[model samples]
Target: MKKHIIGTLLLGGWSLMMLTLLQSCDKQEVFSYESEHALFFERWKQVSLSERYRLDTVNYSFSHYVGVEDIEHQFKINLIGNLLEEDAEYKVIVVDSLTTATEDQYTIKNPVFRKGRSSDSLTVVVHKTPVLKDKSVHLTLRLVENENFGLGYMGYTDVRIRFNDMPTQPTWWTKEVELAFLGPYSYEKLETIVAANEGFTTFEGLSLTEKRKIALNTKEYISEHGITEKNGDPMEIPVY
Candidate 1:
């Protein structure tokens, strides 16, 4: 009777082990998942950046965050410079000491988005040059698709940025300061003001809403009396 009972218990144990193995195999096959590939910058980053950084700014960095969440994955983020089309007034720099960065200058520190982390970053460094002071220059960078990952978002894939050591008036600077009692001034004029009295060199730090408030007042003033000088004389605004 004892031998028969022991045999029954052994058989039950074998069946339980087999079931566990089968379930493990099924779980391995059925519970698989694939995470999509996406590499992007945060939405707040300007799509096209144009600003005057302080002359003291040695290096300017542009970054894009990897959208992939895989821990064991390695990626290559290559920067390809898409130049400005041939125009007499414009300059083309395929590779230069002034534009293309050296190993010491620009580096991809950690392109790998390790396991368990959702994001990684790639940074491009722009070295300041005397040429940037004389004229504003821009370079366009496109994120090419690789075997590991494709370009993530349409809006963020291409980055076009112009940086200058000197304050080149921005395209947004439409109206005169005297008429608006507000913004929109050339770098040279700012320098003049600094030399003569007190002034802010750039409005880059100002919030967009704050900038808009000044613009609104300018518009209201113009609508009421057309743009007038401090002396109450009619002033001309350049369209170009």
Candidate 2:
């Protein structure tokens, strides 16, 4: 009886080990890309990653371009397989149902993976119009299989761009900026600050002294002009 029990335990251990080995082999085969070339949209580094990587959704605005006529919005596309000696052409198509911009509002440029490069830029020419000021528009792009490349990583195959010319708060207006220099933010206060300091777009890259100086100047300007928010609240800057 003792010998039979030991034999049974040994056989079960062998079977479990074999099952694990087979599953490991299957996973390796799934992840292996021996000779296939694939393409995926690269995530922007400035944003935090959601799960394993950041989603390829980009938000753009023309409000930053005070005098520019048009903006060439660009996104990075990455290659998965080995680099080629010659340039490889890739194709991108717009999901019409998901896109809200008309043909005249934006133009998509041809995408190419340059020779010896692992990545390339996909550019879209976004035209600024009066309509964009009041409402936003969206353009969704997807990578399709072409002669030179295959769609890679289902999650990264698509990219969505939301663009507008509306006066929205800049991403640089973080809690740190408010606690350190700027106080509670409002569109009116932002406009007042920009008016006081020519081309003041961001609180970044400015020294503490410089930011304080500009804030003081803006405060004086607000007091002199009696500028108030759209809600009729007093416009104040806390630099002290």
Instruction: Report the number of the highest-TM-score candidate.
Output: 2
Which regions in candidate 2 have their CA more than 4 angstroms from the true location?
A: 1-36, 44-55, 64-69, 196-200, 204-234
User: How many backbone clashes does every candidate have?
Assistant: 2, 0
TM-score of each: 0.33, 0.68
Q: For residues 20-120, write the lDDT of model 2, one tens digit per residue.
A: 98976653323222337888887646434553534477777777555555778778888888887898788899999999987878888878888888888
Candidate 1, residues 1-240: lDDT per residue as tens digits? 999999999999999999998976653423111223444433232345674332111222111111211112112222222221321111112234234333332222334433333443444444455454455454444444444444444444444344445544444344544344343343333333333322333345567565445445434545465545446554332221
| RMSD in order of candidates | 18.7, 6.1
Question: How many pairs of residues collide in model 2?
Answer: 0
**Candidate 2 CA-lDDT value:** 0.78
Error of 1 at 104 (Å): 9.2
Least well predicted 10-residue stretch by lDDT in candidate 2? 26-35
Considering every candidate listed, which one attains the maximal lDDT? 2
lDDT of each: 0.39, 0.78
